[model samples]
Target: MKYLIVGLGNIGAEYADTRHNIGFNVLDALAGASNIAFTTDRYGAVAELRHKGRTLVLLKPSTYMNLSGKAVRYWLDREKIERENLLVVVDDIALPFGTLRMRTRGSAGGHNGLKSICELLGTEDYARIRFGIGGDFARGQQVDYVLGQWTEEERRLLPDRLKVFGDAILSFACVGAERTMNLFNKK
Candidate 1:
């Protein structure tokens, strides 16, 4: 089976290590652990990983957060991967820090990246993994908070959290979204 694992984040050093870039961070960890490397590719950075007889095509969109759907659509078509086998990793401020949730389909919940994906894909039925970045900012500071670098404490805890995130991703591609959600949503 083939799966498209998209990690959404703005492409630039300014965006690196920010809370909004958790998707990229998770993909990086997964790739590193699997001894794979990403290469610059059309609309994104691309990497291939094999797990349990499944091929996972990892993507970190260069289209930036708001325009992520362009890259996603391009890769999905190029890869000829079914929408059912697609997974998007995104940051969520609704949940507490380090929390993770997997859903088969849902609204974008004010995320522009997800909104673009939903719009371009013409449906919200794809799977997504929302990684919590916490909602500790004051009102109207949402943008700054998301693009901000992690706190010292958060940095310390991130490696462990990312490992779990990577594991959940692998579970989704290997065992299917339903089973993976049941296994990781409680974490």
Candidate 2:
């Protein structure tokens, strides 16, 4: 089987290591865990991971954050991967930092990258792995909060958190969504 795992984040020096780029961080973790190298190319920086007889395509959209749809649609069409076989990893502020959530399908909930993807695909029924960035910002501070780099405390827990998220993502790709959710999806 084949899977398309797309990580949503902005491209550029400024967005690296920021809360909004946690998805990219997770994709980095996946590459490291698999001992695979992401090569620069057309769709995006991509690495093919083979696990337990399955092929997993990891992607970090090069179209930046808001225009991520183009990259996603292109990849999905080129790979002929079903919408259900695509997993989008994204950073979510509604949940606490280091928290991970896996859902079979759901709305973007105001995430620009996700919203763009939904518009391109014309559907929301795809798997998703959401890495919590924590939300406690004041009004009009949402942009700063997400685009900001991780706090000292969040950075402290970054390693273990990334491991957990990485493991959960692998499980999802190797096994099934129901099983992955059962093993993850907890406080």
> What are the lDDT scores of the predictions, listed in order?
0.96, 0.89
lDDT of 1 by residue, 1-187 (tens): 9999999999889999899999999999999999999999999999999999999999999999999999999999999999999999999999999999999999999999999999999999999999999999999998999999999999999999999999999999888899999999999
TM-score of 1: 0.99
Off by over 4 Å in 2: none
lDDT by residue (tens digit), candidate 2, 15-61: 99899999899989879987999998785898999988888889999
Clashing pairs in 1: none
Name the best candidate (by lDDT). Answer: 1
